[model samples]
Target: MPNSDYSARHLSVLEGLDAVRKRPGMYIGSTDSRGLMHCLWEIIDNSVDEALAGHGNQIDIVLHADTSVEVSDRARGIPVDIEPKTGLSGVEVVFTKLHAGGKFGSGSYAASGGLHGVGASVVNALSQRLDVQVDRDGKTYAMSFRRGEPGVFDDATGISPSNPFKPFEDASVLREVGKVAKGVSGTRVRYWSDPQIFIKDAVFASEELFSRARQTAFLVPGLAIGIEDRRGQEIAKHDFKYDGGIAEFVEYLAKDAALTATWKLSGSGDFNETVPVLDESGNMVSREVSRKCDVDIAVRWGTGYDTEVKSFVNIIATPKGGTHIAGFEQSVLKVLRSQVEANARKLKAGNDKVEKEDALAGLTAVVTVRLAEPQFEGQTKEILGTPAVKNIVANVVSKALLEKFNSPKRDDKSQAALLLEKVVAEMKSRISARTHKETQRRKNALESSSLPTKLVDCRTQETAGSELFIVEGDSALGTAKLARDSEFQALLPIRGKILNVQKASVSDMLSNTECASIIQVLGAGSGRSFDLDVARYGKVILMSDADVDGAHIRTLLLTLFFRYMRPLVEAGRVFAAVPPLHRVEVINAGSKANEVIYTYSQAELEELLSKLAKAGKKYKEPIQRYKGLGEMDADQLAETTMDRSRRTLRRVRVEDAAAAEAMFELLMGNDVAPRRDFIIDSADGFERERIDA
Candidate 1:
């Protein structure tokens, strides 16, 4: 029923760049903006590789209005001489032939970012038009290509991709455009992305371009990158040069207060790799070569608990990381754990072991490795697959960090001591939180309960629909008990303002009666050991009176939640109950019952009064102003603040934790100088009538 015979006639082979054009994803990774950017990166990385080899120090890039990108560098230009085998110029071979370049163990480069020799060729094939000019040997040579084919463009008016073009039928030409001064050598490349290959909406991202340029400058210290943009009405330009390398990079990435100075670690190791070599007879042979891997790192610890670690391979960014990052983290944890254990008595760490998270917390680091022809996981090069690199990098990091820890310098000794104490403190906090969680979990059994007697808990055991209302005082708690639905609403009453946990130590916070009771009633651990899945309630609502003292009490409670139970806030499960501040009773005509209206804000009350006057409706002269929840009856409180369908609730959210932390520190922290300054600065915006004297 079908033709089963398969023969040689059916076999087809794609030659030159045809295979690349057919399966572009295999080379560039996609046909979207990302792939377009990858092509640009390929060309830029080649120039950067030259700089990495100490051949250049300046590179310039331009983004033209015509959607074309140009890169120029002051480096040894691509050779313009003829090749014996192909009879083509080195520039032509580099751009037209796949898997052909000087980077494949030609002794031209000791280490480079380019591997497989396909970067330049793939970019050339994907570009609609490419122009190359090289200054070498006191002469300037030029070449043009249309989609990987060497040709000439008849651009008598202007340089454009749509200009008339002619491809060489028999032989290609590398024209000697002009002559240059002696000792001048460089290369300039400009290309237009092919619309036929990429999506119509795809365009270059300026931010990504600038970020990559800045990163490269950091990786290769002393290399300057100048960028100019003519895509907008106003021209923009930037120059990036870093002398401190990754140390400056680490400083730029850190956002919180500093706990330690930036430290640098540098070392190298050697490993043997089996690779193919070109024999003298022009044949390929397998041979083993000893390769050296150099690892350089910069690291610092901050006062906040956020980790930022960037890894690179031969100046190329490996954002997803690989063996190098694995090795770095492993070594850091090992060294810190050992240090913490050795000095347990001085730090008061009582048999509590350190964890990987503890070692990484508050750390900002940059890890980079340089090796020749390292194995990459894919064409995108997001990961490294060299197994030996893991151990090599691990050994380097371990030895260098140990040396720093044990350095004889006074500054080094002090910093090491502080860092160890911080890690031990974190370990102890984790252990304490875990102990609280286990103790509370055991008390959750119905037969034997240790929950606070004052907490009026809901009857339901399910957590999804359960709610916890933290009331202001005993008076409000009595009314809430009668207004709440006993099946799902739980109440926990506090006598007055709780301790500000932001300024208090962990032990002080855990030992306070009110703080301990709140933590115990929630049935979840505090801080790093908190398990969100085991939380007793679905929502936490703070209900307090509408006054200055009420606001202060709420702030103190929020400080506790933010410091110890941050996950609940991040998940948007925290809320503030909104209670009406005024009640207006409108007198109806002819014995009809009066209509009562409630307002939450002064503006809303004024608007309602204006509308009622315009309608010629009469209301009671003195409206009732609620000073506290105690003044409201049970039914009124239920309708205004407890009934889910009728009450107004404001959800509390933390969009920027750093900004929130700063504000909390300014207001509640022990440093009174900054708080006094803030209050003095804000005095102009304060009002007189808002305060209840």
Candidate 2:
């Protein structure tokens, strides 16, 4: 059934920017507003890199009416001279070639965020049109591109040989745009995202951009970042410049909280590391390499329960955290434990050490590390993977913390004493709570067999292969019970909506019968006593109706898990089962020519109908749309949702705990204003046709 002529001739290679356009998600994450913001980030990162290199101090960003963005920075402008390697102007090479910037292996920047050198080129590849202007050597040079291809100005006037750059085919080289004032130098970039590459009517959110600009300003001291929105009728402008850097950031985050103590610490050091080097004999030899690094940390402890610890590697936020955060946390915990023991001895208090959670509670800290040649985990650089930086940060933080704690000013009435007292109180409370939970857990274990009467337990004893489906209603549960394989699949039915754990305390949540049943079914103890080893099911799948009500129920259940059994979510054991929403019956002329087709979405239904039409097949009118899982028969439900071989399941993961926690609080918390605002913001791009009710 295949062609025998399939050979080397069929192999295809994408050249230049074509590869980027083909797989844009690989470069910028996705073809949505987020990716569009990423394009802006790439350009802004270049400007920030300039600032980090001690060349730029001012950056201006503008959003145009046409949904385009322009970023200008008073940095050393991009070189205009011809690059010897490519025989092209520096500006042209940087925009057209991948991995062709000064950051890679160049001494121009000792440390930078855009280390892969693909930022500019990737942005160019995804943009519909881009214009670049450089102010260098008392002259302004400009270049333009369309769809990642270089283009010439329509009016090629004032073309003179006095320009330093040479011209390309039909393209006037870096055409001199204007004469800059003496000693003024910088680069300005303007780009418009291609409509075809992004979601429909994609537009940048001004608030998001402003927040990012403010963050950059705080991260880089003395750098002024300004934003102007010309897209709206009234031009909005904001400027951010911070002299205290991360210390100011900490103060800002803790402004509303009742802070007990606040302090900043910083240190720099160089360590010798072994590396392989090539010798004259073409053999590898071991040599010592010196790596320099700087660590700056600011902390503010308050009376609130929230903990905000933001970590960065050379100004790039590591929200997921990595070795650097691990080092910082370990060092803080070590110092706090030592100090608590000392304080307890001095006061003749009970001999008990503070737990990690107690030390981190009510804490707001910013950990920043600047180093040469940092190793990041991924392209987006949400994590730092360098092993040596961890040890270096730990050492620096330990010394600094010890010095601050042992200082003569740390008397009983000092801020240091106040913080230590708070930590010790928290530790005592946590220990008491843990003891109570352990006692309760033992009692609950003995009564675990008294599972909710509604739960239909599976026959299998193999926990690793067993799955528990938390169905929405009794109607759906009835169908699931008839369809599920009794050997490995169990079903638990809940009525209506359960309590929203985001707004409920642990004691309040454990009192709810629905929440209690689900927790007991998953043998993992709830809250602080939770242990992943005791989990009864390999997959705790949330199966609900494909409607708005079902979505609310699912959210309530997720909140319960996220707050009580978070380790289950963190271990990737949670899943969501997607049930088909539409079923189409294809019919032919004969008596035995009826066929059934199931579609998950409206788009898929349309595509299926179109394919049937192309094949000259006829289908009946009035396609059946499933409003709830109860609408599907047991056999159909089994084939579409529960079958291990054909069903679709989405594994839930917590990519950013801080963001996830914030969203959960906003959506499920008692606050209604934030939820209303969130709904309004999300409804901007939502489609009404997708709603079932």
Candidate 3:
């Protein structure tokens, strides 16, 4: 189990690009199609870096028939001058040496996708054949490499990677290929992936290339990217150019109806970091420097519940989501939650805190941060490791959103209000969904025993024939239990009025004892997840008193049902039990017993009295008025309100849901002006005798 004889003899030093060929996965990530694509990306990213530096606005990619990919860009070409350190041409040093390029503190590029300086050299080491041409200094210079060796291919037989190759004996030659017009400069690179290092089936993917090109074009506004595929039987070409930047990218990625316009947030911040610098003597040294980070974000909300966020650093996609994404999400949640909390009463959020998912629901955003030599976690560069960028991005986003929310412009104000309302709605929806799930699970785990304690359950097992009567108070519940048909009618009692759910959040409704008990008793879910088929009873009858206060309580119950369990009302299952307001006793002429008549309202009582008087009948002087359901005896309650054959039940119907919702909101919502105006407008048609004063 132990190798005690291990020594320096066991360690062998690899020179030039030999280390890369020995451990290709260490550089390219894998030996499959993904690794092959990574190598292609290394070359394409070099060209993209040039475009990002504002030197070029066009880039082209070609997929050759031989499976070799080529990338050309109208940017500053690779230097042709001799490198002082290596005593070789700049092209040879860049392609042969590891971690050698012009991007390391040369100030040649302000912000670029490549930072490690190993992209070109690593790609060269992994390619069976690589050819690079530079059009600069009014002349075209060409160089070729056969597996990281400076050489020339003898393509006399054919232009293939299997052609004879000769390495430079003493010195490498940089051949002058052709002449170009003055002041024109660019670079073109074509490379064949090494068969020995990659899988045989590894090939360039045209769709991925096109998508990358299009993304690059969008990231670099005004930059045109053209892709041509010669590998296919029919040559295909695609071109992408966008001037709207990430905003257009957001629009292209959005899949639902927009809830808000695309918003742009742009800003910059400065931070200090200590990094290695190349000294004059070619030694590595660490020095602290101040760097500016530019941030640009485009975001829009839609009607869907999905979230789409694409983040990048220096035009390179960070798909795994690093510090920058964290910061962006943090800022979004914080800002939106703050705004929602500030407008809680207006939106009726009612003590529920907004979560990150709520803030991100229906959101589509593109987050970009640009800085010099940002740290990446791996060679693939899918994640950013720089910690300072998080705070910087968060600061920028927070400032931008705060300004928008506080802006006095009407458009900004309207959007801000709507955004807050949407976030609150998402939060409520999430709560409702969670409660529904919990209710389902609880029903399965505890069965019928989990129902509320005060409920007087029906004896019948059939749901279709069972009715649930929501009585006003314990007094009414006692009489209802005695009067109701015990075989199929259940009783649940509530104290006074339940919360006005039209002005309450889902969490608040779920927390209210009466509301929660009612929902639990029904055995069906609520809100978007309400399942009418799972309901424990077919009819949900609200039984209160026969007076004004009872009417208010009934209205509250109706609001709860209409807002949460709306399907029950729409399916014609929700009803209000009408109790008699007056009981009139009439004396028969001689030996007949006195007859009792029940009148539901003053108008009905007057009509009954008029009819009785015209018929020359004598009755008791005093008429009994039912101030509450508790005042009725069991027989009277059963005959007047509980019996299915004799009772009058008003079925709640939503002929026009939109109008009903507006009416409910005007009466029970937190806003008071509309309700006040309604009362004032109806005052002209008031009748004093109709009031239950």
Per-residue lDDT tens digits for candidate 1, residues 602-689, read 7788899999999999999799899998889898899999998999888889999978877887898776899999999998999865
Residue 449, candidate 1: alpha-carbon lDDT: 70
Candidate 2 on 408-434: residue-level lDDT in tens? 864424767767776776666466445
The true-structure Cα RMSD of candidate 3 reads 17.5
Q: Which is superior by lDDT, 1 or 3?
A: 1
The segments of candidate 2 whose C-alpha lies over 4 angstroms from its true place after superposition are 1-14, 153-172, 255-260, 272-288, 346-351, 410-413, 440-693
lDDT of each: 0.86, 0.80, 0.85
Pairs of residues at least 3 apart in sequence or in different chains that clash in candidate 3: none
Give the candidate order by descending TM-score: 1, 3, 2
Give the runs in model 1 whose Cα sits over 4 Å from its true position. 1-14, 114-116, 137-140, 176-184, 232-238, 437-455, 470-479, 492-530, 542-570, 623-634, 651-693
**Pairwise lDDT winner, candidates 2 and 3:** 3
The top-ranked prediction according to TM-score is 1
